[model samples]
Target chain A: MTALLEVSGIEKSFGGIRALNGCSLTVERGMIHGLIGPNGSGKTTLFNVLTGYENPDAGEVRLDGVVITGIGPGKVFRLGIGRTFQLTRVFIRLSVLDNMLIAAQHQHKWLRSALRSPGQGGERAKAMELLDFVGIARLAELEAGALSYGQRKLLELAYLLMADPDVLLLDEPAGGVNPTLINQLADKIKELNSAGKTILVVEHNMEFVMGICGRITVMHQGRALLTDVPAAVRSDPRVLDAYLGGAEDEGLEAEAVRTEGGSK
Target chain B: MAILSAKAKPISKGKAAVVVAAIAVIAVFPLVFTNPAVTEIAIFALMFMATSEAWNGFAGWSGYFSLGHAVFFGVGAYTFAIIANDYKLPAGSGLFLLMPVAGVVAMVAAVLVGAVALRTKRHTFVVITIGVFFIFQLLGYNLSITAGASGLQVPTPYNWNAATFNNPFYYAAAILLGFTVGLYWIIRRSAFGLQLLAIRDDEERAKGLGVPVWRVKLSAFVISSFPVGMAGALFAFLIGQIYPNTVFNPLFDLSWALMTLVGGIGTIAGPLLGGVVLESVQQYLNLYLSNADIYLIVYGVVFLAVMFWMPRGVVPTVGDALRRRRGAGEATIAATNNGGTDSSSEGKATGSLAGVVQEGGK
Candidate 1:
C-alpha cells in the first residue's frame, strides 16, 4: 500500500532547544497508527509540523505523494489532512451545531459561505448527522464550551470528520477521558478505520493504543525508535525501557489500574 | 430541564417588542423633530450606528480589534470628495454611483493592510492597524490629490434646489441605517458569521478544524470596510466638504468603538442600540454643557463602566439574567407539579447550557 502520509527527516528547534530532531515516520492508507512517547519527546511538535502549524527547519511532509512542507495550516487542511489538538479547541460561545457547521463549510468558497445563511441549505442536516454520529445530537444547541471533556473530544472528532479528510491526525484522543469513554473512543476509531479512513493517533494510553491501533511507532528524544505491529512493539525491550524510565510509567500504571478494575 | 415558566417567554417577547418599538420610534424621529439641529444629531446617530456596526463585525465577532477602521471611512470620504470635486463628477449622477468606487478603494486598502497586519495577533495586530491609520492620515494630509490639509469641498448640486440637499441628507442616513441593519441580519445568520465567532473564541482550533482563518478574517475586513466607505461617501456629500483632520478624527473613531462596546460588542443589534442612545446623550450634553467637554468625559466613564459591569454588553447580559430567573421559576413550577421529588437533581442538570439549548430550540 502506498503511504498516505510521509514525513522524512523533519527537524525543528526553538532557539537552543531541539523540539524535533530528524524525526521520520510513514503511515499507509486505512490503518490506525499510534505515536507514543514521554512528554517533551516531540509528539505534539510532530503533529504541528505535519499540519503546517510550524515549519520544520529541515524536512518534507508529503500527503498522497505531494510535498506539503512549509505550507500554512489552512492550506494543509485543504490538502485533505485534518487534526485535533491535545487540549480541545472549540468555539466556546457558539452552539455545538454551529461549531460543526463552520467546519463543514470548508468545502465552499469563503464568499459563497459568507453570503449564505447560517445553518441554511443542506449544512444543518449534515451538521446534525455528524453530531448524532458523535452521540452529541442532544447537545446540538448547547454552547461547545459547556461540554464534558469526553464529549468535547467526540465533538472535535466530529468537527474533523466534517472536512471528510483522507488522513485524520488525532493528538491524544483518550488523554483525559474516562475509561468507559476510552472504550467508546476505541470503538469509534475502529469504526472510522473500517470505513477506510487513515488515522494517525498520538496516544499515551497503552491499552487504548494496544486495543485500537494496528501499528505503533515509538518516539524517543524526538526520533522514532521503532515502528511495528502492536504486539511486537509491546514486547520490544527498548520500548519498555523508554516507558519505565520516562513519564510513560505513570500512564502504564493508569492502564494497569483500569485493567485491574475491569477484571473485578 | 427547567419547567416552562411564563417569565422566560415574556422576557424574550418583550425584548423583541422593545427593539421593534425603538426602530419605529427612530423611523419617525426625523419626521417629528423637524429642527435642523436635532435632525443633524439624528444623522450623527445614524453615522455612529454605521461605523460601530462595521467595527463590531471584525473586532467584536472575529476578535480582530482594528483601530484603523477609520482608514476605510477616511478613504471613502476622500475618494468621493476627490471624484466629485477634482474630477467634477455630476451630482445628478446619484450618490449610488460613487458607492462602488469608494467601496473598492477601501477594500483594496483593507486587503493590503490586512495581508500584513493579520499575520500578527493580539496587541501586535492592534498596533499595526493604528499605525496604518496614522500613515493613511499623514498621506491624506500631504497629498494635494486629497487636497492636503485643506481637503476637498463637495459643492451642492447646482441643478437641484436646497431642499434636495437637506431632504437627501435624511434619506441618505435612512438608506445607510437600512443597509447596516440588513448587513448585520445577513451576517448574524451566515456561515461566515459562525466562522468569525469560531475564530474569535479560538483561532488555532478554528484553523485546525479546516477554517481558512486568514481568509475568513480578510473577507470580514473587506466586507466591513465597504459600509465604512459608503458612510464616508455619504458624509462627504452631506457635509459638502472634508478636511484630513475632520475626516480622520480619532475622537470620532473612539466614539464608534465605545458605542459598539457599550451596545454589546458581538451582537447584531447592540451597536445600533448603543449608537442611538449614546449619540442622543452626547447631543443633550453638548446642549447643556457648552465648553465643559463633559460629554467626552461622560462617554469615557460610561465605556469604562460598561467594560467593568457588562463586558459582554447590555443585550447578552440582560438576556442571560432574565433567562436565569425564568429558568428558576420554571423549575420551581415543574417540581410542584411533579410532587417535588426530582427538584434538586433537575435543577443541577438544568444549568446554563441546558437551559439555553432548551430555550433556543423552542
Candidate 2:
C-alpha cells in the first residue's frame, strides 16, 4: 500500500543534543503503526514534529502526497491530522460534552463557529456517541477534571476522535489506563483501524504495542532502527540488543505471552 | 395541539420571589430619598453598573484586564462634548450619535492594542494598556477640540423642556443600565461567551481545540468598547461638560477596576453588584471625608480587602456557597430516595474525579 504519511531525512536538534537525527519512516493507511523507544529516544519529539508542534531542522513531511511541514497545530488538524497528548491536555473546567464539542468545532468556519452555539448541529449527540465509543458515555455531563486517571485517558481519546481526523496520533493511550481498560483501548484502536482510519501510536507498553500494531518501528537515539512485522522485529539481534540489552529467550517469551494476553 | 403545551414551567419560585423583591426595593428607592443629591448618587451608581459590566465583558469574561479602558470612556466624553459643543449638534441627539462614534473609535483602539498587546503575557498586557491610556490622556489634554484643560460645556437638547432635561439624566442612566445588562445576557448565552470563559481558564488549550483565540478576544474587545463609549457620552451629557482632566480621570478608572474586581471577576452579576456597592460607599464617604485624596486612599483599602478576602469576587463566592448548600440538600434527598443507601456513589466517584482533574489542569 502507498504510504499515508512519509517523512524523509527529518532532523531536529535542541541545542547540542540531537533529538531526531536523519529519521525517516512511512506509515501506511488503515493500519495501527507503533513507534516504540526508551525514554529520551525522541519518540515524543517525533510525534511533535509530525503534528507541527515542533519544526524539524531539515526534512519533508508529506501527508497523502501533500507536504505539510512547519504548519501550526490548528492547521495540521485542519489538514486531517488529530493528536492526543501524553499528559492528557483536556479542557478541564468544561463539561465532558463541551470538551468533545470543542474538538468537533474544527469543522466549522472560525467566525461562524465562535458566534453560534456549538451545542446545535447535533454536536451533543455526536459527543455522546464518541463518549460511548470510548466507554465513558455516562460521564458526559460531569466535569472532565473529575474523571479518574484511566477515564481521563479514555476521554482524551474520545475527544480526538470527535475531530474525525484521517490520521490519529495517540502519544500513549495505554500509559495510565488499567489492564481492563488497556484491552478495551486496544479493541477501540483495532475497531478504528478496521473502519479505514490511520493510527500512529507511540507507546512504551510492549504488550499493548505488539498486539494491535500491524507494523512496529523501533527507534533508538532518534533514528529508526527497524520497521517490520512485530514477530520478525522481535527476533532481530539489533532490536533485541536495543530493547532488552541482549537478554535471552526468557525475556522474549515473557513479552510474547504478555502481548497475547493484552490482545485478548 | 397538545393541551399540556409545556405548562409554562412556572419560573422557579425562589428566583421569582427574589426578582420581585429586588424590583420593589428599586422602585421605592427614589421615594425613600427625595433629596436630589441622593438621586444623583443613585444615577451615578447605575452608570457605574454599566461601566463595570462593560469592563467585565473583556476582562472578566475573556481574562484580558484592559487597564486602558478609560480611553474609551474619555473618547466617548470628548466625542459627545465636541459633537455637541464644537460641531453645534443638538445636545441629546449629539450624545446618542457620539455613542456609536466613540464605540467605533474604541473598537479601533482595542483592535490596534489587542494586535500588539495580546501577544504579550497578562501583566505586560495590562501595563501596555495603561501606557496606551496615558498616551490618550496626554493627547486629550493637548487637543484643541477637547477644550484642552478648560473643558467644554454641553448645551441641553433644544427639544426637551426643563423637566425633561431635569429628570432626563436618571432615565438615560436607567436605559444605559438596561442596554448593558441585555448585551451581557446575549454574550453569556452565545457561544462566544463560552469560548471566552474557556480562553480565560486556559488559552493554549482553547487554541488547541481550534478556538481562534485572537478572533474571540478581538470580538469581545470590540463589544466591550461600545458600552464604555456610550457611558462616557452619557456622562458628558449628564454633567454638561467635558475636560481632559475630568474625562480621563485615573480616579474613575481605579474605582471601576476595583469595583469590578471586588464584585466578582468573571460572573455576570459581579460588576453590577460591585459597582453599585462601591459607588454608593464612595458617595457616602464623600459626605463625610470631603478630601478626594482621602477617598482614594479608602478606595485603595477597599480594593485590597476585596482582593484578600474574596479573590474570586463576591458573586462567584456566593455562587459556590449556594451550590454547596444545594449539593448537601441533594445528598440528603438522594439518601432518602435510595433508602439511606447512596447509589450515587458511582456517579459521584466518576463525577468528582472529573471535577478535580479539570480544576488541576486549569
Residue-level lDDT of model 1, residues B236-257, one tens digit each, is 8878889887777666668777
> Against the true structure, what is each candidate's TM-score?
0.85, 0.85
Leading candidate by DockQ: 2
List iRMS (one decimal) for every candidate: 9.4, 7.2
Residue A145 Cα positional deviation in candidate 1, in Å, after optimal superposition: 1.2
- Tens-digit per-residue lDDT, A49-150, candidate 1: 999899999989999999999888888888889898887776666667677877777788777877876555566777777777878887775667678767
Deviation in angstroms for B200 in model 1?
A: 1.6
Alpha-carbon local distance difference test for all models: 0.77, 0.74
Displacement of the residue B263 alpha carbon in candidate 1, Å: 0.7
Docking category of candidate 2: acceptable
- lDDT (0-100) at residue A167 of candidate 1? 89
